[model samples]
Target: MSDTYRALTRKYRPTSFEDIVSQDHVSNTIKNAIKQNRLSHAYMFCGPRGVGKTTMARVLARTINEIDSSIDGESLNQTLNIVEMDAASNNKVDDVHHLRESVRIPPQNGKYKVFIVDEVHMLSKAAFNALLKTLEEPPEHAIFIFATTEPHKVLPTILSRVQRFDFKRISVDEIVQRLRKISLDEDISIDEESLHVIAKKADGALRDALGLMDQAIAFCGDTITHNELLQALNVVGTDRLFEFMECVKDHDADRGLELINTLLQEGYDIQEYLIGLTEHLRNLYIAHETSKLYLVEASEETKKRYQQTAGDFSRDDLMRMLHIISEAQIKLKDASQPRIQFEITLLKLIHMERSEQLSELLAGLQELKKNSGNFVAPSQNGSTQKEVKPEPEEQAEKVSEPVDETESTEENLEPQPLNPSTDSEAVGSDGSSPGPKESEIEVEAEAEVDTQIEEEEDDDFDIGAPALITTLARKARASVQSEKQKQTAPSNGAPTETSSEKDLPEKITTEYVQEIWVEYLESLKGDFPMLLHLQMERTKVKKVKGGELHLECDNSFAQKMLDEQSTDLQFKLKEFTGSVLRFNISVGEIDEKDKPMSVYERFKQIQQKDPIIRDIVEIFGAELEY
Candidate 1:
């Protein structure tokens, strides 16, 4: 068989530093060190697998020995001075000592005796100790070069004695360029798109790229296409991934799940599918901010797919989906069924929608209001303002009208009266008052009724308050109504008006004040639903004046919770109601007799109710205590 059948990767391995792909900086530094004759006794090369760690180590060894004709600027069959050792197999202290003893002797013919220790991290602890002394100080002609996929496993003492160079994962473009060069040299034909697929599959490892290329060439013959590469690799193409992403964008979980199932049936690994999906989303996220497609790997076709998908999703939605999928990936390892986990995660991604943060929601509401048109308040001169009143004839007609039987029946079916005394008199089955004790019950009932009424009136007031307050505040600010009316009035000016009218500020309708106050409270409820549930029953809006909103809660804990969230609360309120409302949180004394049981107490009560859990507890001899 020809050499072409012997895997393109090994056939085209880099023979010199310049021939190495995607690691010029590393290569250049090493080459310069050799030229400067400032070579360190020990050197460590670390990076991901197939990113040229071992290849570079071999090249470095040959380069120091002046074996490559390209580097020495001459064509000659040079004898090798470099000695390559596999530390993985020879990991004993004796092997290390033998190597050390050889290292102490000078090269027989070459300028330097370079010992290339591959997978040096695999050396035993004793072997490492034995090698340390030689590594720290070696013969003038000796050089120790270490290469490993995992540098963390190497002893720090060994690491400290060496010059370390980290090799980065090769980029897709670099891998593609290298692959293209190999294709041209080997007289094989492959499309640019197909090359891109191979490079991406390599995931920044040049060796992997070549290995994949070798597979693709064999599987598809010489003229390989993108589809062929995908088929051979068992990878879902970018188009399919984009299609699934679009389904997610449209919130079509079923469609997304169908696509996932199809891919899985096609023999794609669930883990690899997730990785590809994540990368697809990541590309879109980056594309949303940048027009540069190079930031993420892929061909022109793939880039376009990403840009289109990104346009279909908002930044917030995409971020949320990424988070959910990432979390699901973490859970997949321990899951009983990984496919189910993946499907569930995909469903979540599809169903995921953008939800504005509290601040953003408020801001959006405020913006909407600003664009709705200016608010106008009523004029101070009530007589001058247009007021709708029924004419005498209309009032007479209304008085003459008779009620229909349906209307009468509807009215008669009204809710039964809540007679405070009668309701309070009713005895509970346990012989306790239906309500709290007489004095406490009355106070609590009255407070509850007042709070309810206040809330209702506030809602009614808000509808017209914006326009009314806008007109009133503007007029007051401009002093237009007061100044103009003062000039038109009798020479004594406000002498005719009551002294109380002039002294007392324009009284904002109780309804309008209550409405704004209640709306502010509702806004707070949205941000802290749990806290709101606990406080709403016992909380009351005291007053809203000069943009200051006063509220009373039942205890200091509620007050503190509200206070802690005051800044955010104020911002949200201002956004919702367009009022710079301030909060005054005060604790109110509430009767604690009707307070709900604690969680532990509730657990105990539940155990008493359910036979199953109760039996489990009884069998375990568990004790319940308050």
Candidate 2:
């Protein structure tokens, strides 16, 4: 042995453009440009750190000057034509002024003088301004290469002037291949699993992989394995990640929490663990969605494992779990006990149920459409009827009232035909059903809501009724809208709305509007209690005459939010009252002497308003904090 050692990053760094891994598009383009003498005055290499940005810049610098880029050859950095500056440390007007002066001098040794500015985004505003003129029109003998991890921070003027090359995050298999090649070249004995562990830990950074491999070699001697590399790197094992996911999939909160305890004992950072677990879940989700093992970037065994377990989670379940975990992650930073916070989050994920109400409705609708062709012609009495075959659970939940799956809480809502008609009735003068209008559907939706309210167990403030009512109203509106779209498409591009939709009831009363408004507010309070309290609680129905219902908002803010939701609200109202009415939002005027406040604020205001309190404060010379 020569008894000479070098860091793997430097020892195996690509010298030529061809040797650059996983960035063939960049390398080929640069090579073609160089060979064809079609070079830009300034080039920008931007991407994530340790992805061969600075290295590529140096290669370009050498290639332009006809110098060897190999590490074994004379160091390319030593060439007089190439000037590499760390922009982060020297990012000021004076530094850029010096650069401008230097660019003026002609290259003595090479065709061009290459100035590589690493971390170019860190350049100060004044420095960027100073650089702009030169960058826009640089000297013929000077070439500028700027590299940054964040291209977004770079000025548009500077960005527009330069040729930008985006480097991709190297793939895991590519990193593993590179690591294995280096290990073999150095005569190191490491298992394939160990190489995989290093690659996974690198997270698409090839330089990180090399440094990790070097560290592994330094600590683990010539012979290394997966456990040793993981230990050396202080990284959590792949087993824990797979096991934790299994616990989540199984809804075994205890086991999931036990993993947390183990992580704590092992001194793994909680947030870091959460991030890794999230990534692991994402991989499983991808495997589930794509069914491509290669896309997962895991070992064949791990990919197989993911493919097997991925079926346990539907896309909605995975999305819900991700949301729960992300929320916990954000909340964890402020939490006094991170372990407890994460545990609760995991528990939330474990207990989460997918809300497939909309999905079920869509499925039911599609199934109805498919089976509509199988419907037999009407009986002699001229009435057509079709039966739906739902799952056993839905079949068992039969009640006196018909169940519309779109509004079903426990069962998948199934779509029932509004007008199962005879041929004559179906083919109307306009070739559409004239009977059982949207108003009839509204009645069915109301019945569904009433049944849902009756089924719910609630001792606190009749919330169930209002909530189910609003939900049913919204679902009925969707169904009605969908049916309307399909049936009422006009030949002349005019909507074939019913006369009731176009003309309002001639004599609508304020008392009736108030009643409807109260129910609407109740529905709001049921579904969005916080929002109701914040914006809609104090709204007053100003008038309910003609074709419009004018409502008074507390302020302009309430008017704005409610204005955005006006269409949906109008649809709900039309469904609720069986009448089409336009909703208009207006800010209400408060009495100049009467200050508006919340209940708590009003109680404090009352104390300030009392004359006795003022007198007592004056007599005692006491100050009170409310």
Candidate 3:
């Protein structure tokens, strides 16, 4: 054993440009500049720590002065021509003043006196200003080189005066290659997995990797295994992360809790464990999305494991899991009991319902809607009836559930008409009159069924088959009755005698026009596009005189939309009142009282129209906000 032993980081420090690892871009560029004699007076080398920034600066300083390491100590610590300064220790204006005075003296050995400043960003503002003049125009024999982990902190004034070179973090593979070479040169017997763990723990910093290797050698002697290295480094094992993810996939909350207990009991840092778990999830996501195992920084066997586990979760579920894990990572720092918080976080992942794609959810809803239309309702006698097409006059006679025979009168069976003032019905293409009010009832029934399913969704409960069947059956019945009513109404071919034929209105009154306007909106409920129906809902009947029907709206956009549909509306009115009335739609101040009610207010008002909506909303344990 050596008493004056050197740490691996300091022992393996590169002496020349060629000896630096994974910095070819910077080394090549600087070498070309030196060959061309185009060296900038001030150069800034910046990047993450241990990625060879300061090392590159030192090499550049040595190269500029053409100092041969064989003669001039390889460490460059004993050189007279090269000056090294750490800005962190001496960052005052007086330090810059001292440096300014030192640079005035010519080099004693080399043509150029090179100055290397590390952690340059730590300099005070006053120091940077004092150094800025020296940087802008230094003596022909003096050269300044700056290295910093954070270049953004340096003043823009100082940055503009220098030629900047950015260094990148060494990749895991490169770090592993470097570690392997060092291990072989030093006669260390270590497994490949242990080397990989050290490289990954370095996080793209070769110096850190070397330091970790030194620690491993001290703890595990000359021989190192993967398990021993993990313990020496205090890192969580990858197996624990893999097992936790499996528990999440299978929704095994109990197993997830057990994994958390084991992790804490093993003396793993809660934050470090979370970070490793997050990385494990990221690997799974990459495998699932790109199917490129190389994108994940793991061994071949671990990549294969990721590939296999990737199939268990969809991309949407993986994204959600990542989001939850990221939030927990942030919240873990403030948690009073980190173990409890970690356990809760794992349980949340295990209990999380996998997210379904939007298209899949919509497809499911459509399939349910289609199936609901065919569902049969049970009668009072507990017998199910198969719905069949009805005869013309007997259309309204068929009902879904049994009722008292006495209540089955003509008045009870007839659909309440919206247009009580007009006798003529809007004739359809098939020669029968379509009942506008009946279609409105059907629309309301459909809305009720939709709300019921929504209520179930809000409660986080699956739409029960029984509840859906009942709601769908009611909707189906209403739809069928409306369809039959439209088909069975008296057509132009049939000259049926009616009270309207005997007593036709001689004149169009405001009241008559208003009633007809409501029926027009009701008629649009099912047959027309919703925009037209909704627009008509917002209109107010302002006036009706001398064959002119005036409608008012709040905005010009609404007025324009109504104006476009006015001609068709006029035709509808002619069919009802047998009058060619002109529609005058204009932007005007409509009274607040005339505006349509909000959905919640309307539902409350129309509860009597369909009490089942209120019942379903309550029974499903959801508030009908709309």
Candidate 4:
């Protein structure tokens, strides 16, 4: 061994334009310029850090001056024709003055004197002004190439004088391909997952990826695995992200907290973890909603994992999770306790609500309406009334009773004068029937109100009964009071039962209770999303016995939420089922199949069930939207 080490970034740096990755536009243009002899006097290479700006500047310098770019060649520093300067350190007015003087001299060996100024934006204002004169009137044998990450910092006049070539950030696939080539050349053994991890961790910077690969080689001695790479780089793998999301899907806040703690213990940066997490969620969203698996830059196994897990979360949940993570990332910069912030973020994701789709809501509404025939609103006297459509016999009896009472009252009323001065005026000046009897008028009014109520019930099915209850109460108050008076009459007769008492379910069953349970949940989604999540989605109907309804929840968070809303939930339950059933809620075991399905999984199920939906999904690439 020579005991000499050249880092992979420098060793594998692209020497020819063909070797440069993902910058074909710039490379191709430059090659054409070189071939056609259309080279500008000065060129500016601009892009992000570590994105081949300086490298391209040097390559252009060598290419234009007819110097060999082979790594085995003698150093270019020996030639007076090609010069490289670090403008970051040599950016004073005096440096530019010296450069101006050097430009006056002809090339010593090459066709032109090429000056490659890295970080040229660091040049001072006076230095740029000094350079402007030399650039405006450059020698025939001199060429200038300036490279900078921030091109805006260069004076606009200086920018206008130079031809600019923007280098794009290398794609993950290109970086991975380059890294694989390097690994093979260097005789290093690394798995595809390891390469993917390094490529993604590079974040479009090939130099950073090479640096990480060198670090991994030094740490792992050529045989690199994904786990070792993660350990060496101090990065949390996507497996950790998968685990965290699994915790979220299961609603296991404890596991979520533990994951955060484990990451902290492993010496992983929370900010980096959050960045990786955001990308992972993005990948999951892409995998869930689209067929473009190539968009996810990962190994086959990881991509499959992403696809499988993508079904465990809805797009809304993913979006919210991403939002939470982004907020945490921002807050972490100013947070007094970063770990706590991260913990809180994870907990929020774990306890986050699953979004209800509009179609699901509409379906639920339809089901509620379809089942509303069995539903009843509670009466004003704290009693339940079944919303039954009155039988034809009952309708006939009601109208006939009112008419009979009206006729009897009319027969009893003596004939009176027309009373033209009063509000009531007799017809035809006859005064034979007087204007109308008070009891007959009352019967007519009662009959009219009854007809209107029956018509309303027949049409809308009393879905808005609660909202209209007060109005209906005012209209029926007279009839109710009259019925009460008859009921209170001091006679040794048997008491009559009300409609509520007669229509109440003789015994509550699990099936009816579940139907009411579903209806109650549907009612919450529109008005109380949070309540629906807490009390509805996570709770299961364990059993319904008599007046006691036992419910089992998977976690304490849901149990606590249910407990807090127990009173209102029980009331709603009774209202929907027409039985005063009490909730016996307990935090206990729940079946996995009964758990809430993610958006993609639900859509998949729907697609499987409906051929039209399946065809639409296949034809139009339709995704389940929130």
lDDT of 1 at 169: 91
Better candidate number, 1 or 3, judged by TM-score: 3
TM-score for all predictions? Answer: 0.58, 0.55, 0.61, 0.62
lDDT: the better of candidates 2 and 3: 3
Task: Give residue 222's error in model 3 in angstroms.
Answer: 1.6
Could you tell which candidate, 1 or 4, scores higher by TM-score?
4
Total clashes for model 2 = 3
Pairs of residues clashing in candidate 4: none
Candidate 1 global CA lDDT score:
0.68
Worst 10 residues of 3 by lDDT: 461-470
Ranking by TM-score: 4, 3, 1, 2
**Model 1 residue 387 CA deviation in Å:** 24
What's model 1's lDDT at 56?
A: 83
Kindly list the per-residue Cα lDDT of model 3 for residues 1-626, writing each as its tens digit. Answer: 34688888877888788889999998999999999998888889999999998788777877777777664324675677788889999999999999999899999887888888899999999999999888899999888989999999999999999989999999988888898999888888997777778888999999999999999999998899888889999988777778888898788888778778877788889889878878888888898755477778767877788888889987767776777778889898898988888888778888876654343444344434543443356678974543323234333243322222222335434555546464455556677766444444444444444344445433442322222123333344445545554556687757554443454478878888777677666655433334455567778888887778888876554566567667766765675677778988887764677444443445566565777876776689534310
Which whole-number lDDT from 0 to 100 does residue 559 have in model 2? 71
lDDT score for candidate 4 against the true structure: 0.74
Window of ten residues with lowest summed lDDT in model 1: 463-472
- Error in Å for residue 191 of model 4: 0.4
Top candidate on TM-score is: 4
lDDT of each: 0.68, 0.71, 0.73, 0.74
Q: RMSD of candidate 2 to the true fold?
A: 24.9
Per-candidate Cα RMSD to the true structure, in Å, reads 17.6, 24.9, 17.6, 15.5
lDDT rank order:
4, 3, 2, 1
